[model samples]
Target: MGANDLAKGPQMRTVIFDLDGTLADTSGDLIAAANACFRGLGLGDLLDARHDAGTALRGGRAMLTLGFSRVDGVDPGEVDRQYPVLLDAYARDINSHTFLYPGTMDAVTRLKSAGYAVGIATNKPEGLAETLMQSLGVRGEFASLIGADTLPVRKPDPEHHFEAVRRAGGDPRKSLLVGDTATDRDTSRNAGVPSVLVTFGPGPHDVRALSPEATIDHFDELDAVVAQLIG
Candidate 1:
């Protein structure tokens, strides 16, 4: 039997979400943190939000490394050394520039009201993820928040997705992941679940080209897409 077939009774349905690029535009704040580190080093804004947004979504070290690459004296070791500092800075001001994509709360509310268990499965660190969600006042909406450090491994590694679904009391085979990167697509594929990629994320990838099960340019289209994919 397929996952839905097995879940014919009262088993919970689930929708797993990616945080940074998918649920919210966290690049501005993320970049601010990296820029803070560079400013401390007297570099004074080595990375520009418009240009390095994709790298920002990739994580702190990626942003730091990209910034260091543009300067003469900096090296990879410097990026490593400043990684924690960036995280600390980001943690302090996590919600300053971060806002949910339009229609996010509406879509999430629809899912919850419809009895689907919602959860986050992001590559962001677990603690940071919790802080961000709480800062945004949406922490209680999700049944679970599984992050990079929540388990021994992260996305594209099926275990991460599986754990998120399980924690939400949903069957993995019946779950769907809403994300905005190739990594998220690969994670869904590896976990044997349908994937939906958002086109509005800061990532430079052509989400449609990622060949996710579905592509949504806006959160307004999410409910129908989720229904078609899993229901």
Candidate 2:
């Protein structure tokens, strides 16, 4: 019902994952899409994947804003106008360069085997998130996906995480959030759920500064970390 509700109800184990930079390295494709939009405007590739990886994970608007800032005449309005174009380009080739983090699927399988319901809570648009997961052949693996557009609010809005757990049929009180950004850490705190930040994301935030409940360098350590946090 609310953020407090996430800490109530029967204990039902669940793990909510942040898609980009957490479960998958989608920055390359994201940057490419943004670059495609800039190129269409005859501005050429405005952002580089290596340089703007963090912005890419933050989403299209962030990347567009950053790119537009670097150009001479582009403004927020132009960024807004080009946002849909970026999405269209991304949708056309969602999986061209996107890839799951190493050992992600194995960890996910282990979680499923251990009877923990798994779901996704990402800031990406709902349709794009669905498209990416389906294109990558892993849509069936997740019980639920709550994206930026899935509800009126998104992370660091805890309601997004709460809805994800509920949709997964898992009790929010027994849920853990696995992500790669401060936004996810805040979402977990707001939801009263333990947070685990992975070091593999494109974001530049120091995981130590975020002070998550736990930090993991690789998905290989996820099972033990999740068990320790919420099991």
Clashing pairs in 1: none
* Root mean square deviation (Cα) for candidate 2: 2.9
Q: lDDT scores for all predictions?
A: 0.92, 0.92
RMSD of each: 2.7, 2.9
Question: For each candidate, what TM-score against the reference?
Answer: 0.94, 0.94
lDDT of 1 by residue, 1-231 (tens): 788876574368899999999999999999999999999999999989888899999999899888888889776699789999999999989888899999998999998888789999999999999999999999999989999999999998999998998898887878999999999999999998999999999888799998999999888899899999999
Candidate 2: minimum summed lDDT over ten consecutive residues — where? 3-12
- Model 1 — which ten-residue stretch has the worst lDDT? 3-12
Off by over 4 Å in 1: 1-10
